[model samples]
Target: MGFLQPNLPQLDLESWRRGTRNERMRPLVAHLCEVGFGTPDVVYLFYVVKIGLYLLGAMAFAVATAGVDGLFSVGDWWSEPIVFQKLVLWTMLFEVLGLGCGFGPLNLRFLPPLGSFLYWLRPGTIRLPPSPALVPGTGGRMQGTVRGPVDVVLYAALLGTLLVALLADGTRSSGDLPGAAGLLPVWLVALPLVLLGVIGLRDKTVFLAARSEVYAAIAVTFLFSGVDMVVGAKLVMLVIWWGAAVSKLNGHFPFVVQAMMSNSPVWRWRRLKHRFHRSFPDDLRPSGLSRALAHGGTAVELSVPLVLVVSSGGWVTAVAATVMIAFHLNIISSIPMGVPLEWNVFMILAILVLFVDKAAYGVGDLSGEGVLVLAVPIGSAVLVVLGNLYPERISFLPGMRYYAGNWDTTVWCFTPSGLDKFDAGTVKAAMLPHQQLERIYGEAEAEVPLFTGYAFRAMHTHGRAHFALVPRACGESHDDDYLVLDGELVAGVVLGWNFGDGHLHDERLVAALQERCGFEPGELRVIVLDAQPIHRPTQSYRLVDAATGELERGTVLVADMVVRQPWDTDLPITVTPAPQVEC
Candidate 1:
């Protein structure tokens, strides 16, 4: 790949457009398998620099908070309880501000290159309520108005409250532990939580964008005192790692590893990328190497934290900490597409702060809270179970299944006019998917990046399944009448930011779009695929028309997806067409 330019596929536009779906996807798939995203070295370097800046900014926050003296002096202050708490707050601020996860070209974001705070802080921006029917005082003008002054103020207040809390000096503790000198005031921590939760009720966008599910839970632990605070933080990390690991015990995970490793810039050789797949075209399941990496990584995630939490300042603690740090570093070095660089960095810092440095704060160190100690992990475990069983009900973030390949995914097939209607209809921060491509590559050349996106989606197992099922989902609609885009791209346009979750664009989002755009039955067709359950080989899928409603619901076996090449769209689907429901 060129330093400034992406390697583009050499294809005759007229012939490519007229070709069969698989015919069009074939060249792109070969290109991707060999070149990955074909992302330029310059772009990768840019993200690396951004990662450096993020770490420096966190260190600066730590120093400014009087938690550390110098950047290199982490050895001296790394264990400070308040420092860790402020780091969590600081990371949350960074993410909510649109600079953390799902930022820039890697996530197919351009123009503004981000959408979280940009969308949330603006009045008249769209906000998706999780459940408008169930929540009282949630309907009427408050439901989906142009974000009024109050919404903007509330979002700004959440940001401001978080900043103030990060800057606030924690009260000195009457403890003997070396790092347990100060604690964030309960009210200071609680204020942002309440504000975030309240704003989230109105805008699930802000909630998911802030990653309130992960960071907010950690922030709540800051409200506790003494050993409870330490134990609470430890439990939260355990949930994150354990939950993610547990979620990986499935048929879909190997596919994720194969795709992720193929996309890894660190693994530059095409041969290495090819090895992850079973073969070129016929047998495209994840290779043995991919499965080993997937399962081994899962084991590390599941086992290391347990060893870290239990080992009380011995060589065992040292080895576990090293493994955990290396684990996160490996992920960071891979430079995954979502560019969750800062999140991985934060996890590394967390290992040092909570596990290695605060090693003594185990279950035996628990203070007044006995039963409550088990509640957080147990509750998180239950969510993981429910999340896996019925993924439609929970966001993947809360489900804690980070990068385990399996995720709720959707594909929206839109007519050209339908795309225009969406642009005219929705109150959004970013341009439509095609529009963003146009801005970056120019109107004349936009289709290049546009189809490159399709290829990227096809690299994943769900992409193959979703697109393969689209014809059946949309009925016998003419191919030229619509364009296919990942639901994350649609979510980016509608919800501000999407970190690879289809829940953002499921039936709920369909209704929201229909309410605004009034799309005709053929204008917009969506397929929502749920993450696969651990014990089951099949994953559930739902099809809905933007104008009409549910059209089909079904299951696609994992075996069908992994066996096909990236360009292949002939996956066997088991459909249960639903009676047409009105919007």
Candidate 2:
């Protein structure tokens, strides 16, 4: 019976194969499956759109550069070939477009509306639920599995193109435009295409690597290009000025001649100073042993740009090159492990300036010599008067109070000492009033005369409290004094205290609160404490609250008050009301 059943299925299969529908649709089904598995039509569409946008951005850059004569000067002579210049221009355009796409919203319009609409139409896509397959881990695994075939095809294409380009003869051009090499352009285009192919195939890994490489390339190119542009611009300006002078001399105008001669010496002096300053400054400070050692670790830091500049042309070219170098150094310094070269260059220019005038105007000329001699003394006298009028050595301590302003509303009381002292148990019984007095007041009262003299001056000038303790004064005493001042019990003390100075004792703090604010011992209430620091010369508090302290619990009785170091002063503080107890 089982054999008969199998034979019956075989007969049915034979009948189905012979039917008209199977015969008509087999090839079409196969073709559809092949296209679905092998081609990525969407990716190609994106690439075309991106290229168009890049071309548009490049055109914009070129137009902008044309208006700024200082940016795109070709100079009287061109060192680089026309082809090389074109390549640079294209590369710059690509960079600009890439940068715009990354930072700006210009590329968002390229996404296919049809695909987005289709995605929204699907219930699963529009309202995704938490499914195991949709989780990150599953998606990552799927991506990993799918990427292998794409990577193989991409790498194979890249390798084949590279090998063909390398092996092809440059002299014997195979394509049209005979005898002229067509391969160079092909190679140039292929290089970036291969890079993009590899980057696209690798997915996330390629994204990070490509992003870093693109940024670095853009930065390096900008530095070199800027230097080239500056030098070229300066040369063009010099030529223009020289031409104008020659035209005036050739003309038959008496006024032009007189004007040219009258300004001749001044122009000459300016040119001399500009050249000297551009090369080396008047205050060129060289690196000492320590500085040299530090800088020497990065040998290429300064040498690479110097080499590029020297190779391009000598000191004249170096001026623009050095400026670019300084710019790059400034950028790197903004990161880490780098120092800005601008200050160093400025110092060099200063040193150069002192002697530049003397060299340009010889000692034999009375007018030139007199001006040069008087420059230093005249500059010194002016600086001296300014320095005396506005002394830089004003005391920070004396200005604290003026800077802090009103203290009572801004101050916070947190310690038990700032509360009622008479109700506590065993310790209160043993110590009595004398012990309580010693614990609360400490030696600070005795030393207040000495410390207050300085503190009062600081408070009066700064309008803020100095929380620092007097030397030889007890810790509790310092806290008491600071609290008293902060609570407005003391007439002249600034309200704020530096957490570093041990001014957070509970007993002293509570005593000040009780003495000044009229809060009874063991009374619990929510209190908000401000933690702003007072700035000198501006009597304002940049307030912040306590973060993680007894006050952070939201609600708790004043069970214990302990003073700890203040690290982050701007955190929020929340205090809970305490239960009242009979004394």
Candidate 3:
């Protein structure tokens, strides 16, 4: 790939024009392993610039806090507990503003580059309530989906609350350590935490936008004073590390490494990139090298955090922190699809501050109410437990399943009928995904960029399974009848942004769209694939149409998908037909 241009595969342009969708995949998916989605070098630079803006914005927020004043002199006050607390709030605010994880061309946001604040602040947009029966003031007149005035208030209030907290001064000078800076009052930090919880119950889209799993945990720590707060934060990070490591125990994570490296701007060597695949153009299944790296990294994530916490201020702690720092830096350099750049940088800071600087303050230092602070990590662990067991109900983020190649995924299959309805019926902030891609790459050559998005997905283990089942979801003549897309893309078009949580675009979401678009039976079809449960070998799936309800329900063996190529659309399935609808 050139610094200014995309190095696309050598293909017969006329042959591609004549080939069917399945036929096109043969070359496209292969090219994905070697050349990636053929994204231009300039686009990666665009993300690098965005990362700077996000960091500068965060530091500005922290600097506004009365006690903190380290712009050019970060080394002077970087270790202050107050600085740590303020940055946590700023990160939550950053993500909530749609500038964090799912922002820019990396996550497929091309036109305006983000949809969070735009979609949430507006009235009459779509909103998905977690449960209308349990939560009053939810489920609008339009089949429990429309965003009424109440929805707008809840979202805006959360943003306003976060801003108020970010700009507020510290409550008092810290007693935890001599000369430590003042910390944000417990109430100020708690206020946004409460609002985020309320907003989450109202709309998971806004909730996930904040990247609450990681940020909320840090926010919880701010409520505690002194040593207890930092130790509690360390434990919370531990759970996150453990959960991510355990999730990688499956046959999926290698796919993540290969795909991540394939698209990475830092990894310009194509031969080294091909090394992750079995034989590159022929057998694109993960090579031994990919698995070794995936599992080896998993071992590091699991063991290092424990050592970082258990080892009191010493070389052991420093070594553990160094290992973890290198781990996060490696990931950040890859500039993975989700573009969780800020989070990685924060983790590096966390290792330095919480684990290394405060290494002497262990959980043993907890006194009185500080012991109760243990509940934060305990609660996070329980969520991870439930997430792994019941992935369909819980998002991978909350389950602590960060980038382990396991995800609840969906494939949106649409004909012109459904597309027309979706285009006309929904109230959205951004243009349709294909439209945005075309606007960026031109209508004639948009497929190169569009399929690049799919390449990223198929690099994951579940994505291969999702594509294999697309035929069954769209029907036998799916290739000719429907244009298949990752549910995340469609979610971005309709919901404004998607951070890889399929629940945002699952059957429940389809029900919401069905209420508005009123699709005919053949118009819209969705294939919802749940993340593989930790205890189960197979992942369950559902096929649904917008007009009708479920069309089929079944399971696809993980064994079948792990071995197939990215474009292999035929994996044998264990299945049961849905109750047929009458004309």
Candidate 4:
């Protein structure tokens, strides 16, 4: 890669465009292998400024809460329940505002750089309700753009109520911590939570987009007063760590670590980056080092929180807190794609507030509590287990599987006309992917970023399966007939917000597109890949022809996937072709 300009493919324009998709991607892959994404220095600086701004915003909110004083003097009120509750609401507001994850150019969000609130508050925008057929009154049309004026007004109210709740000062609680403020008024927090729940039923996009899984779970804790509130928060954090660790016990996670390390802005040495993979070309499997990192990281996530929860202050608490803070700091510094930056910041604060500062609230403290105390964590664990076993039925956020790399993913192949249909049909925040590319970098230069994105996906194990399914989905049609796009990008355009969740665009999404675009049977094909179960070595897949419905259903071996390079398209596939009955 170049010092200033990204290293362009070393080929003549005609020759570059003449090659097949993966063929043209070879040089781009090599470039990424050396300098992943090669994100400009200015972009990194911009993120740094944003992180500072988020931190400053949180501190300002902290001060506004009754007991809190200056930012530097957080020690005086850091353990206050109100302080922590406000932080949770504040972070949720930040995320739902579109300033959080999936923000900016790294996620290919250039035009407005965000989609959350922009799409949610607009009356004509699309809202994806999970499984409309299963619920009454939600059965109008499965297409994503089905929001009515009521949906828009409710969404706006949810946002507004949350802000008001966050700004509302705490009322006195019966808790024991001296000089520390009580909780935000029960109704203040409760009203917003209820609105969030109601809006979520109508549209899961707004829920997951706000990271409702994390913040909502935390808000549920505020309902309990005194020591129970502290214990509830502690248990929620435990679920996040342990649940994420358990989810990572799959063959796919090592590949995630390898890819993330290579793309890490902090790890700038090209030699060190290459070490994460087995070889430059012949083999691209995760290296021994990547496997060790994944295992070691999992161990920390699973075990350290236990120590943090049980230890009552002093050396043990201090040590565990420092280690976990460093852990989050490392992830933050890496600048992982999807830019889940603010989430990491919140985790750091959680460690300090729930575990370190208020270290007295341990497992023993829960003995004073009722059955409800045990129920919340137990319920969260059950949900995690269910999500792992049946990913199609649950969003990964609630599943508590952050960055396991084994996620339900999809790849959409659209013919030029199919792409045009999407542009004409959707309520869009930005132009379609290729159009945006061309607008920024002329038609000729557009292939640079375009192919770079393909290489990025190919770097993961799922990329192989996605491509392997393409032929089966396409059948007799030439592969180049369709422009392949990540389902997340399509989700961002259609659903308004997406943070790496495949639930946003599964079979239901295919129906939605067909309803709007009315594509020919062969014009649009989709590959939906489910995350592997913790107990299983294979992941399931479905290929749907938009106009005609599902063409096949089957499984892809995780064993076969982990062994190949990201660009290797020869991965084996098992198909159960469906009997086509015309609708």
**Candidate 3 global lDDT:** 0.82
Q: Encode model 1's per-residue lDDT on 1-583: one tens digit a residue.
A: 7888887778888878777665677777767766777788898898889888887777777776644577778777777778888889989999998898999888878777888877877777667777777764446653463466777899899889988887777675725456534777789989999998887777777888888767888887766666777787788888889989988887778877877787787888877788887886545667999999999999999999999888888899999999999999999988888888899899898888888777877887777654365666667778887887777788898888788788989888888888888989888867876887787778867876777677767777787887788788766664566788888888887778889877788877887788788898778988889988777888898888888887888899988887777777678888876578899
**Weakest 10 consecutive residues of candidate 4 by summed lDDT:** 1-10
TM-score of 2: 0.19
lDDT (tens digit, per residue) of candidate 2 on 1-583: 1211110111233443343321212222222111211113343333436545544433333323212222234332112211122223343223322222221111111122112112212222111111224433313432222324444344345334433333333322222111222223334334645454443434322222122222212212212222232232222222222222222221111211111221222222333322211111221111132123223322333333333323334454455445544544433222110111222232222212211211222223223223333332233333323322221211111111111111212233333543333233111101222222345346433222222222221212111122221111113433333222232211011111111111222222333223334444323221222212221121212121122123222311111111111111122223334567989
**What is candidate 3's TM-score against the reference?**
0.96
Alpha-carbon shift of residue 504 in model 3 (angstroms)? 0.6
Local accuracy of candidate 3 as per-residue lDDT tens digits, 539-564: 89888888888888899889888888
Question: RMSD per prediction, one decimal?
Answer: 2.5, 34.1, 2.2, 2.2
Residue pairs that clash (backbone atoms under 3 angstroms), model 4: none
- All models: lDDT? 0.80, 0.25, 0.82, 0.81
Clashing residue pairs in all predictions, respectively, total 1, 39, 0, 0
lDDT of 1: 0.80
**2 versus 3: better TM-score goes to:** 3
What's the TM-score of every candidate structure?
0.94, 0.19, 0.96, 0.95
lDDT for 265 in candidate 2 is: 20
Model 2: per-residue Cα lDDT at residue 555: 14
Q: Which stretches of candidate 3 lie over 4 Å from their true place?
A: 577-583
Tens-digit lDDT track of model 4 for 1-583: 3434554445687878887777777777666666778787677788889999998887787788776777888667776778788889988888878899989877888887887777777877777777576655567654434888878888788778878876677786736654466678888888888888887777888888788878888788877766777788788888888999999988878878887887887888888878887886556678899999999999999999899988889999999999899899999998998999989999999999888778987656654553476677778889899988877678888997788988899989888888888778778877766678798879988877888888877878888888778777776454568888899999888877778999898877778777877898778889999988777888899988898888789999989998877777788887767678999
Better of 1 and 2 by lDDT: 1
